[model samples]
Target: MIMRRPAVAGQFYPGNENDLRELIKKLAPEHTPSKIPALGVVAPHAGYIYSGRVAAEVYASIEEAPTFVILGPNHYMYGSAVALSTQEWMTPLGNVQVDEDFIDCLPIGIIDKDELAHRSEHSIEVQIPFLQYFFKDFKIVPIALGLQDYDTIKELAGELVKAIEKYDERVVIIASSDFTHYEDVDVAHRKDRALIKTIEQLDVPAFYDELYRINASTCGYGPIGAMMMACRERGAKYGKLLRYATSGDVTGDRQVVGYAGIAVY
Candidate 1:
């Protein structure tokens, strides 16, 4: 059995299991909000210190699902344009199984089941601990995208919907992403908010247009677009931004990466 080990445990999050749990508990908001059966969500993938609270808010707001399809950018530009990993992912929390059946249901050739792409990618890896925290029994389908063109993302979303329909299982798609990168705190918020407004409308094209217009350095545009497309195809009407912050908020750094937690239902 192939095991995908944690690549950024000590760096992006705590290496110790107990510490990871404790940190998540602390990052999670004290007031509980009734969870929504969201179709999809957009969560950030920066170091937990920078974006953990944003991610926690997104996960905490969503209703638990039997399977979660996580789409994240292939930041290293490795492997196939659209790559999927079938290996069980390991975290400090435990091993989380991949939903192989769901992958099999997807139309062939569109996504390469390439483990190389996910071997060291941190975007998808960081979200698992949060899942392990909230749900007792759940599986994940992790897709790393090296390509984010409009046609490609739309096609990918179509196949995703097809797989969901065939499997008939409760599932949610999580697009792991961080917004503006390495910009002044004010600049990051300005650009990210403009791009986010398009996302709130569920207008994928507008999101892309605004992204290119501002030359926003969002690392997961493809993943975010894919999620919006798939969720809309599933009859999701609107998206809500549960939280928005930046690394600057945590460190008071002049340059920061924007993070947002949004839910679609």
Candidate 2:
């Protein structure tokens, strides 16, 4: 099996195993994850120092599961709206096995096995280590979404629901995304709050509507929208915001990328 090694390791997070472990622990510092069932979660995908704490908060709230369906934006990839990979992903912590079997089970017919689409992408890659930190031996099905069209996301959500029923597996869905990018801190908060409000209500239509209404720049919104639909299908009533921050918090810059951690159960 081809190994999907880290492409942004040294730049986005620690390159060494010990250092990576220390950083994760330092960010979490005795954080205890919830045992309650989780249908889906949303976490940021920037560098660890800027977004790790918030990501950890959402991860901490999710109950342990054998498999995770991780959806992330295709920031650099092209050609396919949905790119699915069936390879082991390597991170500083260790190798996270891809759920190849589950990947084959998805009912969506538009997806393609496009490893090249994931080669230079950091969004999904950034979430692997956090999953490794939380669970000892869990597989992940990583999909990079390049489009945020409404009908596409809605159809993908329905397919996911059918796939879950066909497989009869208890899985957790995760969306790796930043709230808003390169906006003034005040404007970023306003845009992100509007987006988060829709998220909390689990209103897929409102979620998609407000995204364009406010001109929000969430890179992985397609995945977030799909996960929200899956959450609602699985009986998730609401989403709780765990944490929200921005690059400005770390760099002291006026222009920042908004980040948030939300859990749906």
Candidate 3:
């Protein structure tokens, strides 16, 4: 079955190729990464007007890649984990092939097949145009994470590492997420900074703990948890919070959604 592109394209991002290219060109970093990372990245998935610059920070860090394993929150559907639509995902840019081999290797009990789960999911879809712009040609294993607990995230992450270990292709792990939704501007910055601090310390557990305690409305908590586990397993030593801001900063609104760009190396 064909997986469709479902997002507010022109509204959220530029629909025209030339316009989109120009936007990406304007946002892309002037300096390229000297060495490519294999481990983890956390990027926002809000509209381009709100999160494009922050998202660019993470995407720009990756010089090139043949494959990426993307973990994103299940926004439109609720479940444990949905390995939905192993078909190519369509975007205005082009089709990004799903890594069927890697999907096949996932532990059977952990993955569920459900296309409806992905139909209106913008979390994963929003990242595609950015990936297409930067990488040009690459395949992705798209995994939609649900409301699973932290321990479950760790277990799944371990399985993910083992599943793709034998592949010769260079793979990047991208966790698509937006931080702290619909708080006042001041509140958003304060909460996002606290979370960023935790990420910088590589304290994933502490990050979750603090988020729960403070009720930081980060939607990608599950994906972040999984990414932290995967990064640890891959021996990632450092994390850098590249950019952090809110929709308020972009739109000059009091009510805002937070966006962050992070790199784990």
Model 1 C-alpha lDDT per residue in residues 1-265, reported as the tens digit of each score: 6799999999999999999999999999888689988999999999999999999999888899999999999999889899999999999999999998887899875889899999889999999999999889999999999999899999999999999999978989999999999999889989999988988889999999998899999999999999999999999998999999999888988899999999998
Task: Name the regions of candidate 2 deviating beyond 4 angstroms.
Answer: 29-33
User: Count of backbone clashes for each model?
Assistant: 0, 0, 0
For this target, which candidate reaches the highest lDDT against the unseen true structure?
1
Q: Put the candidates in TM-score order, highest first.
A: 1, 2, 3
lDDT of 2 by residue, 207-228 (tens): 8889889988888899999999
**Model 1: which residue pairs collide?**
none
Can you give the lDDT of residue 105 in candidate 1?
92
- Deviating ranges (above 4 Å) for candidate 3: 32-38, 78-80
Ranking by lDDT: 1, 2, 3
Candidate 2: which pairs clash? none
102-121 in candidate 3: lDDT tens per residue? 67766655666666667767
Residue 113 in model 3: lDDT: 68
The lDDT for every candidate, in the order shown, is: 0.93, 0.86, 0.79
The better-scoring model by TM-score among 2 and 3 is 2
